[model samples]
Target: MKDLACQQFQDTVAEFLIRHQSILDIISKSQESNARVNRAVVKAVTHCGCVKVRAEKSAIPPEATLADLKQLLDSHLDGELCPNCREIIESEMGKSIFYLTALCHSLGLSLADVLQREHEKVSTLRVFNFT
Candidate 1:
């Protein structure tokens, strides 16, 4: 079901992305979309004041294990995105996904397969994946 949705989205993007058919265009647009997504998050934090980031160094004990690090670390994000900010963020994220899917289409890759492989890797590796 998820794969079907991904394929449908990819097909839609391939159909509509007439102007950016070149690989270079697709790559550049993908980067631009990612930047837009980042900008939206920054706007939410800086302009909206709905969310605050209190990032700081994590103070881990000398005796702490790898699993204990998860409990000690924090995202440092405070509060939730207000409706307006949330909408903007979601729209920007959608554009990112669209361009990502377009890239996959241009490369003859399946976004669903890529997501599934990553999911399996993380599930199997668990906390050790990053390390």
Candidate 2:
């Protein structure tokens, strides 16, 4: 159960960050009494970028495959993120997931509930597509 929570938290953070690419440079901290988790997430996302860095959202174009999305990025970024950023993002993401998993253990809050709330916030933002 704990392991699943960790994975879910990681996935949720990735999705939210991917959907909100403009804030990639910002380090979002928790406003709750405990901020360690949020700080971890901010660090992780910074290091790895998103699994799927959708530059902008449109309904998935009819012919697009996940590979295409990744391939596009590979061709574009040259070789994913630089080494330093990758390390930072991975470490931060791992820390954040661990904290969130701990929250699930202590507070009985489902990862989905927290992730959903975060996604709701992203859904409301205005995203501009340039292509």
Candidate 3:
């Protein structure tokens, strides 16, 4: 959906994806294509899905522009206008990155070492349901 909406920048995104494909492919391969995640996590990942279905006045892939992505990524919470939400989200992201790094280290793998094994599959929790 995000990709389709970014069609105007199709070429740019395609090139970026190509440069980043190795990491993307590995992370994708690490997770089972069909598996149930924690119910709460599922809810978060599917938030856009819900919004899409319900016709809410929230952001969709198409509504999102390059500037919005940049704002979300910039380190300054001041840019967000809502500092508390921005801080909370960034904090959660930090914890998630730490969790991924530690888990990867314990498994003798780099963060990019995420690859699915046909014989066994494990859960990867990207977010904690703190909110």
TM-score of each: 0.96, 0.33, 0.28
Model 1 TM-score, all chains together: 0.96
Q: Model 1 clash pairs?
A: none
Per-model lDDT: 0.94, 0.49, 0.38
Better of 2 and 3 by lDDT: 2
Give per-residue CA lDDT, model 1, range 8-117, as digits (tens): 98999999999999999999998999999999999999999999999988899999999998899988999999999999999999999998999999999999999999
Root-mean-square deviation of each candidate, in angstroms? 0.8, 12.7, 18.2
Largest TM-score belongs to which candidate?
1
Q: Kindly list the per-residue Cα lDDT of model 2 for residues 2-103, writing each as its tens digit.
A: 547656665665555532233322223222313644444444355555432334444456688665564444322223555665665576666555444444
Best by lDDT: 1
The lowest-lDDT stretch of 10 consecutive residues in candidate 2 is: 24-33
Q: Please give, for residues 37-100, the per-residue lDDT of candidate 3 as tens digits.
A: 3232333334422211223343437677654654444332121124444354455554444434
